[model samples]
Structures are given as C-alpha cells and as structure tokens.
Target chain A: MRGKHIKTVMVGGIFLCATPIMAAEGKLLATAGLSQLEGSGGGGLVPWATLAGYDSRDETTALLFMTDVNITDYRLSSIGVATSFYDRVELSYAQQTFGLPVGLVKQLSVGEIKQNVIGAKVRLYGDVVYSTYPQLSIGLQHKQLDDDSVATALGAKDDSGTDFYVAATKVHLGAVAGYNLVWNVTARATKANEMGLLGYGGPDNNGYQMMMEVSVGLLLSPNWVVGMEYRQKPNNLSSVKEDDWTDLFVSYMPNKNINFTAAYADLGTVATQKDQKGVYLSMTGYLW
Target chain B: MVNHLKTALLMMSVLLVACATPTKTPISLYEEIGGQPTIEAITDNFIDEISFNKDIYRYFEKTNITRFREKFIEHLCVDTGGPCTYTGDTMLKVHQGQKITETDFNLTVDLLVNAMKKAGLTYVQQNRVLKVLAPMRGEMLYK
Candidate 1:
C-alpha cells in the first residue's frame, strides 16, 4: 500500500510539472527554504517562516526531498514531499526511519522504527525580504509511529503526538558586508521524545512544553549559502535525557530545479548514548 | 632656494586638499555603477527581455516603448540619487488598472536583474539597487 501511494504521488508530480497552471518560479533564488527534518520549510534542524517553494501569490509549486543522518550508533533517513499554495500556505508529508544499534535491536527484539509526519503551515504576515517587518508563520506537525511495542516497553505515554510552532524569518539584502543575511526564530510546543522516534511523553512528564529554535545564514552568492541552526528539544522521557541539536550547514543551489545541502550535526545524547555526532546530507528537487 | 622649497610644498598641499575634498563626497549608486550609458543599456536590455518572455510581454503590449524607455531611465536616475527628476506617472497610478499579480511582478523583477547583469553591474551593486527599489513593490502589485 505504501509503495502504491509513493508511485501515485510521483505520477501526480509529473502530471503537475506538465500543467500550464504550474508556478512561475517567481521568487528570487534561494528565498524558499529547504525542507527541515520533519518536512517543514526551514534549515536542517529548525523550521523557518518561509515556505517550501519559490512560488508567488498567484502560483503553486511542489517539491520532493530526501535526507540522511548517520550518527554514532544509529542512523536516520527521511523522505518527504511538500507543496506551497500561492506562497500563503504549505503542506507536507514525510516518513522517517530510525535504525537501532545492533546490541539494542538484539536485546529489544526490534531492528528499526518508522514514523510518519504530516505538516501544515500558514503564512501570517510580511515577506522575508521586501517587507519592513519579518515574515511570520504558524504551523503544526502530526506524527504517528508504525509500531508502539518499543515505546510501550520504554514507558512512553503515547505513540503519537502533535507539535505546534510559530516562526519569524527575515532577509536583509547587503546587510553583511554586501552579502545577504537571513535569520529565523521559532518557538515550538511539543510532548515528543526524540522527535517521536522513541515515542511521546513518558511517565515522568505528560504535558506539552515550549522549546525554541534559531537559524542564521549568509548568502555567499545567489547560489551558495552558509548557515548554522540550533534546535531545543523537549525532555519528556525521564528514562533518558534529550539534548539540544545543532548543525553547521552549506547549501548549494545550481538552479531552481534542485539544491544540495551538507551539514555537520551534533545531536548530543540519545538513549544513554553520549555525544552522538555525525554528518547530515539532503537534496531537494523542484517539480514545477 | 628656501623660498622655492616652501612654495613647492605649499602647492603640493593645496593640490592634496583639492583632491581630498571631492573624495569626501561619497559616490552615489548611479555613478558607482557607471552613469547614463549603463542605465540606458539596462533599459534596452530590459525591454528586450520583456519582448522575449510571452507572459511578461502581454503586460506591455499596449505600452509605448519610447516613453517607457525615457521615463524608466529618469526614474532609475532619481532612485539612485542621480541628478534627475521622474516626469512619469506615480507607480500606483501607472499600475492601478493593470491588476498585476505577484507572480508577474516578481517575474518582472527577475528580468530587471538580468538586465542589470547584462549591463555590467556587480552583484553588490545590483543588491544596492534592489534595496532602494524593493520598498516600492507594494505600489506595483495587485494595484
């Protein structure tokens, strides 16, 4: 069934690409942000206010992305599709696969975990560059795990959860020694543990908590960007400690059709493992 | 001999002062990007770009190319702090009946950027020009 769904989506993407109502690629280069881990438009670890495509108010655009993170003792891979409508609203779907360490898989009798995330965002006000004020947006991500046995064994209160966030982003042309500078700040409320890979709230905590995230980037040129992002994680699971996430990334956009990003990520500790750090790589292709 | 040396030093200092005074007046964006010739070239290139783009060309089908050329040059000159006045209609008035969509407006901007690039404007220079004109986007979109 999942394979059928993916095939249908790809066919639809190709059909949209051939339609006359497709987006005009109206916005400036690099203005539309890359997909975040949860499939929202943003940096590697933080969601920004910008949408996922460069469409203007009169057009619609769709894109697909794949991301991989190989950290110490674990690996994660995500695939997603996103679309923006008239630059006012964005919707996305993503599936994440988390590979467990050999020892843990043998001990717990589970090799990997899969989760699905559905996201929606609405732009509230302003443009990132043209307006006097920063662009603001509100969004949510609903996550569900494929299986709950591991979560149940780990004392998780739930296998599903939702995260609500508000983000503000801005771009200042020629602000830094004639180079464009972009920044974003986001506040999210959630009860997820390890972004819901290990599951939602634990016995110690069962309520949603607010966390903050930030991203800053400098456009070295119209095609190249260097940036840093920080994401604050919720400590809902008492059995294990959750640490914040940080990354230094470089993105290269040779054209509007595609972009590639590579990052050095520090994910901190997860499930009693200390200092989980690794490289994260992602690619996005614009279909329209 | 002493008097000659003093007079020579005095002349050298006077010349230095004269050159320093003009340097104190910062170069305007217009002059920094090559004055009238570059502006004219950008206008011509912009017109060519519009003519080639079918979507953008529709908006200018009824426009008078000559008047647009003259007025656009003047408008850019004034926006860049050059010595010129805009004799053309206000942006709002000009675009009121057009009902321009955001996509079309931004597409126009992209054409303008291409024009600037062809006219030998540096990336920094192009950004500076965009910064000055970006604030006026509201007047041009969705009239």
Candidate 2:
C-alpha cells in the first residue's frame, strides 16, 4: 500500500511540474539564454555558460521547454525542464525522440530512437554582463538510450554514458552600433554518436573524443536575439560519416515568463541521410 | 608589369594618406549620457523613485535628500569619466553599518533601472552605467 501511494505521488508530480507558476519579480531581463535542445540554457544547438531564467543571486528560477526539429529526412522532438538555484547551479532533465523513414528504419532494424538526458551545471566564475571576464561554467550530462538491441546492432558498446564540458560566455554591450553581442565557446569530451541517438562508444573506438562548439548572439533589442551556432562532432562509427552541424536562429521574449525561438538547421548528415537540413522551433515557460 | 607597378604606387599613396590622417577621439560616457544637466535630472528622478520604494526606503528615512542627490550626481559624473570629483564616502565605508542584503541591493538596482528608463536614457547608455555600478554590489552588500 505504501509503495502504491508513492507511485501515485510520483505520477502526480510529473503532471504538476508541467504547469507554469509565477516566479519572483526581481530577476534581470534576458540574462538567461534560451533553452538548448538538450535542456541547458543556451542556443538551439549548443549550450552557453549562462544559467536558465532571470533569477538573480538570491533567488531560484524554474524553466520548462518543448522543441521540435523537422529535417528533410527526419524529425526530432524534445521536452524538458530546468531549474537554477541562487544563480550558481543548475539541474535539468530532457527526453528526446528521433524518428526516421520506414526504409531507413528497416535497414537499421529500428523505427525510432528514444533517449533521456539528466544534466547538471555549476557556475565557476565571472559574470557575462557586468564583468570584464567571461562567465565560465562546467556541465555534465548523463544520457541513457531506451533500446539496447538497436545500439548493439549498430556496433555500440554502451547504452548509457556521460558527457563532460566546460563553457565560457561573454556579453559585449555596445559591441556593434550600440547592440549587445554574446559569444560562447565550449569544449566537450564525449563518446556519443549523434548525441547518443545511435548510442555511445562504437566498436572502432570506445573512448571519449574532444569536440568544440561555438555560439554568437546579437541583441537586437531588450527582448529579441538573433544568433548562430556551430558544433563539431566526432566520427565514432566507421560505417557512417559524421559531419559538423550549424544553425541560424532568432529568439523573442514576450515577457519574463515566456519565450519563443525559430531556426534553420543544417545537420550535415545523420546515418545515411545527406544534407539533412530543416526547420527548428522551441517554446519555453519560466517559473520560480 | 608596368600596370601592376602603377596600381601598387596608387595603393601605396592611398595607404600613406590614410595613415597620415588624424583620428578623432571618442567621447566619454559622461558626455555620451548628456553631461551634467542630464545626470543631475536622472539622479533626482532616481532618488524620488528610491524614496518611494518600500524595500530600501527604511534605510533612507533619516537621510538628507538634497545632499544625497548632489553626492550621487558627483559620484556618477566621476565614475563615468566626467570632470567631477566624488566627495562622498566609499561604497564599503558608507554601507559598512547598513546591514544591506543581496535582495536590498537588487531592488535598488531595479529602481535605478526604472528611473533611467523613465528619464529617457537609451538601453546602451543605461547598461553602460549599470555595468559600472554592478561591481559595487560586492562592496555594498553585507559589508
């Protein structure tokens, strides 16, 4: 009976967490970047050093996000939530679904791939807006794939693994004709192929490889941002050639609690699909 | 070869002329923010806003508004590279016994941002001033 009650409470908690609640009123405007695809506070494709939400040093902020990407040959969808405490540390969770064509699915013996990502980030030093030094953060993501059989067929050695990264972000006020510019650089160590949709640690090499990611944003106004991102990936699977990803995006905040983003993404190639380019859209709601 | 030589000579002359031309020095933050009169007006408006704010108003209950206004204007002017000197106490010295918290500090900044907006300061100008003031949070809070 006790176990049944606990299970019921857990199910209720998931539903309650999806609703947006009113947050504290004192956070600075647009200090937090938009939610990345993996649920971190960042651009569309890459994570930045900024924490999620507008909460200042003394408050806590919560964020919920949903995103969809439609490429020429595939579709990716994600839903996640994140929280930042005292503007110092962040915790996030996301569930991703990758869908492919029926022919490709048959070839790979899989219809779709599903993943769950648990992420944590800690601010180390500096302020992106008010300091001369760039804000620096260290983050980790532990990803678990749902289907181990498909991963095994693709020469994957592990179904779950952790990615470690360090990111630096800086905001330059009045950088170009009085507009603010935000720049970020991140170094990641990971063994995940295509962010673990194809699983981790291929047969050729079951070791982590270092990769670089970069994002730059221009503040067109206090509530609008235009940005671009580039992310380099490692070639873990010899059968498939992995290429870099790039995107151009625009984000708008209607108020402190709501934000929307749209982008054009060039994923290069995934699996056997070539020139896998498409549209990406995301919406996020903030709570305190 | 002769045409290439002529192009090279023309390019060299243009480069030399560009190098010889005098460049104008950029204006300082004080002048860019409209100098003394504008700053004084902003300070007065900011003081009014702060005086009405419930969060930090208790700290200013016994203060002198006129002197505080003058000191604030002077402080901002000197901080922004204007030809003025601040005669008030340092941030740490003044807030040493105030027992200010981070919430108090943030509220004060919020009021200041609102006042700057009300006074018609552009976003860039307001951020420039806020950047200079933001670092003072360390010295003024809980000290």
Candidate 3:
C-alpha cells in the first residue's frame, strides 16, 4: 500500500539525514569498566535504558545482561538482554521494574511498577572500532507496561505503549587517544501518555515522547570502560513534566560470566524538583 | 558522592585484582606460540592462504599483511600493556572487501592456528591467541 511505502520512505529519510556510516565496534567491556556506560555490571549490559549488548560489530554471537537502580526515594530498577548476529542485525529485550521494595534502602517505598521492552536493531551504514568506517544502526522497541493495573492504580491514564528509536553509533576512540563518542535521538510514539501520570494528558499531537542521549566512552582497558551519558526525554503531555538525567559510570567485566557497575547521577532540573543526585549499584551475569 | 566512592573502591579493587589475578593475556600464548619467530612464520602462512582464498582474496590481494601482522602484535602488546603502539589499519578497513562469512573467516583463523601448531605451538598458546583474536568477529565477517 502507499501508506506502507510512505512510512518506509519516512523512516529511511531519518536514517539518511541523521547520520553517516561509522564503525563503533569492540568487545564487551569487562565488569569494572562496563557498569558506568550502561549503568549495569560491565561489558554486556547497557545500564538503565539503552542496551548496547556484549559484542561489537565483529562479534557474531553476542549475549549480554545488565541492570540499574534509580536513586530517588522511589526504587526504579531495570535489566536488559541483547544479541548481535549476521554482523548487521541486533536483538534486545529489557524489563524495567519500578516502585518495588528497596532491598538496599529503608524509607520511601514504592509499589511494583513493571515495564517490559523488546527491541531489534539493524546496522545500515559503516562500522565502528577497528573499521576506518562508521557503523550506523536503527532500532525499534516494543514496550509493554506489564502491570497495567499497577500503572493505572498508581494513576497512569494509559498503562502500556510501544517506542521506536533509530540511532547511529560510532566506535573508534582508540585512534584518538582512547575516547569514544556517540550521539543519538529517538522519537517515540507511546501509549503511556504524559510521562505515565506524572503529567496531565495521554498521547498527544507531539506523538507522546522522545529521548536524546550522547555518550562518550573511554577505554580504561579493552574489556574495561568508563563513560558519561547525558540523557534527555521531552515532556509531551499534561501530567508530571519529566526532567533530564546525567550520569557517569564505570563498567567492569571479570570474564564472560560476571560484570559490575557503580554510578553517580544528577537527576537534573524538572518542572518542580531541583537538582537531585544519587548513586547506583548493579551487577550482571550471562549464560553465553 | 556514592558513585565516586564506588569508583574508588573499584580502583582499589582493580589494583588488588590486578595484582592477584594478573592480566588475562595468558603468558603461555607467547611461549606456546614459540615466541616471535613462530608468530612471524604463522603470520606469513596466513597471509599466503588468504591471498589465494576465493572469498576474501580481493581485500588483501593488493595489500601486504606484514604491517597487518606487526599491527596485530602491537594490538596484543597494547591490550596487555606491553611497550608498543598499534598504528595499523583497523580490522574493518583491512578486511573491507570480498564478503567474508563467519565460517570463512573462522576457517581461516583455524588454519592459522593449525599453522601455528605445525610450527610447534602448544594448545594453550593457540587458545590464548584465539582469545585475543576472537573479538574481531564484528568487522571481519561482513557478508
């Protein structure tokens, strides 16, 4: 149909305008250095939200797992899994469980708020890491608010939604003094409506939401990494206007089996809250 | 605050781990490989094999693997913190043409390992070398 053709064309335009081919490839950062990049344990897991996985472009079968803990009185945690195959395609799944028991903390408890996401990433141009070229990738994530009742009971107008993001990643810091830079933007059409009840309305003309993040990864060692990410999501609806977050984390991987991470985060300016900072600790283990 | 504390802990832990665990680079890799001469010999054979390989021969037909081999050594050196700089073409650039599959490249890798063995490398050394080379799957197998 023309509709389908138009949609494909639009998507292709986004890829063409936004990035050039690049090669952002490398091994999974071991635990100690990886935790900071994705807010998870190390090589395989990409912290709280974004999922990079264990293998770079050169890795054929990549298996990874990661998790994250938010610092506010509310306990927000996340876990992710990812795999890359055929050198051009990647698959990932993540579950974010929030408002649960703060096994580590004592006060300010929140109920169980769970969100699940399954994503697919495709490489379109260039390659990172050892390649002189850049590798560009686009991905889509179908997310479900697993416990709609929980989100609704907690006051969300719509409980579940799907989000799609296309990103271009570049990986070659080793040539430039061991520093890696990445820039990405994702426009998401979500059903959760207005930051999930934090704001006012549901999905709007703005199409619900968007996230933009830039990460600079440093190679402390080949299997070790430390990086900082500036992540931002727009407030599209009427409820609780969302804020932005900046974090610095270190990722360390001991081997294929284990990884660890620790981070310092600044939950920056919001509609109401001032600068709030916190700490994160997480670990990941893999079968691969 | 807590993040910095954790970093400090990790740094301290890395030192301890670094001391106790030693680097994972595997000492036997260099030894089992029969050191410098053996690696050089295997490197030559690997170049020869790939130059005639039907699949990826186009990528290296015009290029020499001598610098590539030296660069490989330097990559190992830098990764393991030895005194060297890996200033060679990236894996992606070096293997940019002719379409290599995992099977094709892996077979080549195995052949190189076999060559090393024939040249008198130990199993431990072969595995150790493979460990360092295994991460190259990203760009080398582009179909």
Candidate 4:
C-alpha cells in the first residue's frame, strides 16, 4: 500500500509539470530599466515613462528590486516588487528604511525613519522606438510613514501624502554616432518632503509644488548603458534646507532576467547634512 | 577603306566608354554587405530560426517556405538599394488577416536579429539594415 501511494504521487507530479509557463519576454533586454528609489521603474532618483518589466501588448511581467544608497551622513535601503500588464499599466509596493547617523540618533533619540510607498503608472501614448512621437506616462506615488514622531517634531504638516507626475521618454536609434540615445522629461507635483521620509508639507509650504526631472542615457551596446539624471526638489522646511539630487550611473543587463546598476549619487543635502554624496547600488530580477 | 573602318571602330569604342563613366556611383548597402549572397544567407538563417520557434512558426504554418525565401531575398535586396526588383505582394496585403500582436512582431524582430547574427553581421551592419527596415513596422502590426 505504501509503494502504491508513492507511485501515484510521483505520477501526479509529472502531470502537473506539463502545464504551460507564461514568460513575459516580449520586450527587448534592458529596455524595461532599473527600479527607481520609490520602487517605480526609472533611474536612481527619477521615474521615467517606461514600465518596470519587459511585457509587450500581449504579455505580463513582474520584477523585484533592491536599492541601497549610502551617503556621507546617512544610509537608505529600499526593496520593492512591481508588475506590468500588457505593457500598459504598472503597480508597485515598496518599503524604505532611512537610517540616521549614530551621533544624530543619539541626539534626537530616533534611530531610523521608515516609510512605505505604493505606486501606479499608466502608459498614455506611443512607444519609445516604434512610434513617431515620444512615449508618455502618468503616475502617482502614495507614501505613508511608519512613525510620525520624527516628522511631527520636525514641524511637518502630515505623515502621509501623494505625488503625481507625467513623464515623456524617447529612444532614438543610431542617433548618437551609431548608438541609441534615450532621454526622459518628467514634471511632478507633490507635497512630500524628502520623498516623504521627512513627511509632507511644513511651516514653509503646505501646498503641492511642481518640480522637474530629466534623464539622458547612451546605449554603448545592447547590454550596457551609462546615463545621468537631475531631479529638482521643493523646499518645504524652513529649519533645514533641502537640496536637489543628481547622479551618474552605469547599468548592465547580462540577460533578460537580471540587471545591475551602480551610480555616484550627489544628494547635495539631506536633513541639514551638507554636501551629502554616496554610491547607489541596485539590482533587479525579472519574473515572467 | 580599311583605315577608315578602323578609325570608326575606335571612335565608337571611345563613345561607349564615355557613356558608362557617369553610371559609376558610390557602392550601395547591398554591395557593402556582399550583395545577393549575404541576403540569401540571412534569409536562410531566418527561415531556420522561424522553424525552431513555436510562437513565430505558427504564423508561418500555412506559408510557402520556398516562395517566402525568394521574396524575402528580393525585398532585402531592393530595400538595400541593390540591382534587383521586389515582385512580392505589399507588406500590408501579405499580413492582412494575421492580426499580429506587438509582442509577436517584436519577437519576429528578435529572430531576424538572431538570423543576422548567425550570418556574421557586425553590430553596425545589423543596425544599418534595421534602420532601413524599421519604418515598415506600422504596416505589419495589428492588421
């Protein structure tokens, strides 16, 4: 009886393995891009119009990413998962831990700041390569702080807020000395301060502010790319000056399943720490 | 009379040489890629690649491989400014009822790239070919 039961279980497992597997490999390698800091698909600091996965019009794709930024005074760790459907829409969730320097933590009695971001993006029009016009997308990131004590003591108005943005991206084939050139422009409206790590709004400003972000990249080959990004920021706190962010990055995609990116990020200033710069390292794994 | 005939023949030969001089234009992309042989090689490689892919192969299940091979070569040649004519049907007409999706279209492009790679095309050469042919995507997709 024992032998018969084992035999039947093995046969059932074999039948289950015969089902088709859906692999979302319709898009080209590296075109989907690395995950942004907020768990959206983009560069290190700014979100672009491209979705997070390689899904095409008839496919669906999902991905997971982890990004770490270590600056002169602080460190941030982020991990997230995102999925795209039919190359049309994307949804993402992320958690971030912002670690304070030991000295600052000792003074403020706070060790870290934690936040969660839920994001959604929709492709509005056109494709990056095939269409005559640039690809356009609109997205939103909703953020909530795990503990509001730090933000409340810092004179922030809210512990939760949302950011809205519209992005346009394009890829020009053989445009730069026979290599592909990609560029994106995004306009965002937000009330988040320091991307919601310091909370939303403050004594200086309680209304949504508009900011601009830009990124340009050169595809050295099919699998390698280098780029730079600049993101303008809003100054909401009067106690500490917030600064804009910039980074220069290199990304490599060995295959469709994985991507690795490293960047020198110049965050300028964060929470009163001046001249904050660091290395940003990230990796993404695609699940079809 | 023999001398006169010889002078006439020499003058006629000079006139023929003068007529052919203006037709010597720069080499075209077809010649740059080694012309018909390379085109045929790419097409052969493409057919082999299609036969191995189940998704793309289904689109060609009813297609006549022999005719496709000939027409594809001619299309590549003409599109590359070669000394040939494309006698095949229009791209839209040929793909009328297929209703190809964007994913499959891109997949087909990937196969073609693989075929070009197998035929030993350099990256730049491959890009050049794609640049010329990429604009036809509007005609092939969703129709």
lDDT of 2 by residue, B65-90 (tens): 88889899999998788999899988
lDDT, candidate 4, A175-270, per-residue tens: 554456777888999998889999899999999999888787878878899988878888888877887787889999877777889999888779
TM-score of chain A of each: 0.92, 0.91, 0.66, 0.92
- What TM-score does candidate 2 get on C-alpha atoms? 0.85
Cα lDDT of model 4 by residue, B39-143, tens digit: 999999999999999989999999999999999999999998999999999999988889999988988988998998888887666766877888899889999
Off by over 4 Å in 4: A1-22, B1-28
For this target, which candidate reaches the highest DockQ against the unseen true structure? Answer: 1
Candidates 1 and 4 compared: the better one by TM-score is 1
Candidate 1 ranges with C-alpha deviation above 4 Å: A1-24, B1-25
What order do you get sorting by DockQ, best first? 1, 2, 4, 3
**Model 3 alpha-carbon drift over 4 Å, by segment:** A1-66, A100-110, A149-157, A176-206, A269-276, B1-143
**TM-score, model 1 to reference:** 0.88
- In the range A63-178, model 1's lDDT, one tens digit per residue, is 88878898998888888999999999999999998888998898889888999999999999999989999999999999999998778888889999999999999988766555
Predicted model with the maximum TM-score: 1
User: Which pairs, if any, clash in model 1?
Assistant: none
lDDT of candidate 3 over B4-109, digit per residue (tens): 3354346435433433544444554455345566666766676666766765566566665666778766665554334456798787877777477544564476
**Candidate 4 steric clashes:** 0
Report the C-alpha lDDT of model 3 over A67-174, residue by residue, as the tens digit.
Answer: 455555454455555565645666666666555435512332435556666767666765443344445556665656655553443344555555555554444332
